[model samples]
Target: MTDHSLYVLLRKLEDAKIPFTLARDRPDTIRVTMHLVGERTEIDVFDDGHMEVSRFCGAEDIVGDEALVDRLIQENRD
Candidate 1:
């Protein structure tokens, strides 16, 4: 996200007293992770001011792209 948007988001989180951790920070993107309501949530902010949010219910909730899934299945085939 743009610097302004990232700043605003961090400010809001601080104002709300929500605890979060920085998973990654780079020139092109920033990743924030937090736990809420017993679930893990992740937010990725891009330099273009675009954002994506993902929530995982558990370990089983993690997933990959179709190609990755296919590879995993093939590797495990009997």
Candidate 2:
């Protein structure tokens, strides 16, 4: 969570009714527990929602599109 990237992401998630947990105490961590894209997976929405918790060093390995991330985040919202 870098300067309201969390806020923006959170807004999206909350809008779509997606399930997510927010920990502002940790800037590098955003925890989300839910089934997304396919199977059950946990994702750590990072700056611009570019990180995934399921994969190791996912930032370098996995790339999450902004729109998809926004939509995904939104999906978990209310």
Candidate 3:
């Protein structure tokens, strides 16, 4: 994702009142964790503008470039 897109995503998450933690996983990757009811969804942003999301307790990894944070949040809501 581009910088603008990432910024917009972050703002949208904030505006939606989702609680999350942002951290640097490496020099080229930034990780964001959205805390849900019983599980946490993670978004990893790479330097090349790529992003992937995975649930903390999920058995499969969700990887893609499309913006899917909203859907992920909706799925884990209490």
Candidate 4:
């Protein structure tokens, strides 16, 4: 994603009290992932501002924040 968008996302996550880590995926790509109680969410940001998010959950259902996932998906997609 664009630098602005990524910054906004990081701010949102911080505001929501969600803990995540950012790492370099490629020369022009960044990867952000959050580790929740029983699940994980990953978002990959590209230099051109495109993004893709994936959620991984265990067999049991969870009560994590759905709004955050929705916002991420809505904001970042092909």
Highest TM-score among the candidates is held by which one? Answer: 4
- Which candidate should be chosen as best, given lDDT against the real structure? 4
TM-score-based ranking, best first?
4, 3, 1, 2
How well is each residue in 25-72 modelled by candidate 3, as lDDT tens digits?
A: 689778888987668888887776688989876434557544587777
Residues 1-78 of candidate 2 have per-residue lDDT tens digits of 545555666677788887655544367677665434444445676656575656332233356678889999888997
TM-score of each: 0.61, 0.36, 0.62, 0.66
C-alpha positional error of residue 18 in candidate 1 after TM-score superposition, expressed in Å: 0.7
Q: State each candidate's clash count.
A: 2, 9, 1, 1
Clashing pairs in 1: 1-45, 1-46
Tens-place lDDT per residue, model 4, 1-78, is 545767878888999999999999689879889878878899987877788999998866555698989988999988
- Tell me model 3's lDDT, rounded to 2 decimals: 0.79
Error of 2 at 13 (Å): 0.8
Instruction: Tell me which residue pairs clash in candidate 2.
Output: 13-73, 13-77, 16-77, 17-76, 17-77, 17-78, 18-76, 18-77, 19-76
**Model 1 Cα lDDT, one tens digit per residue, 17-72:** 88888866677889877667667888888877788999887554547789999999
Give the TM-score (vs. native) of candidate 3: 0.62
- The segments of candidate 2 whose C-alpha lies over 4 angstroms from its true place after superposition are 1-3, 23-27, 34-38, 45-50, 53-78
Candidate 2, residue 3: lDDT: 51
lDDT of each candidate versus the true structure: 0.79, 0.61, 0.79, 0.85
Q: What is the lDDT of residue 34 in candidate 3?
A: 90
RMSD of each: 7.7, 14.9, 13.9, 12.2
Worst 10-residue stretch by lDDT in candidate 3?
58-67
Cα error, candidate 1, residue 37 (Å): 3.1
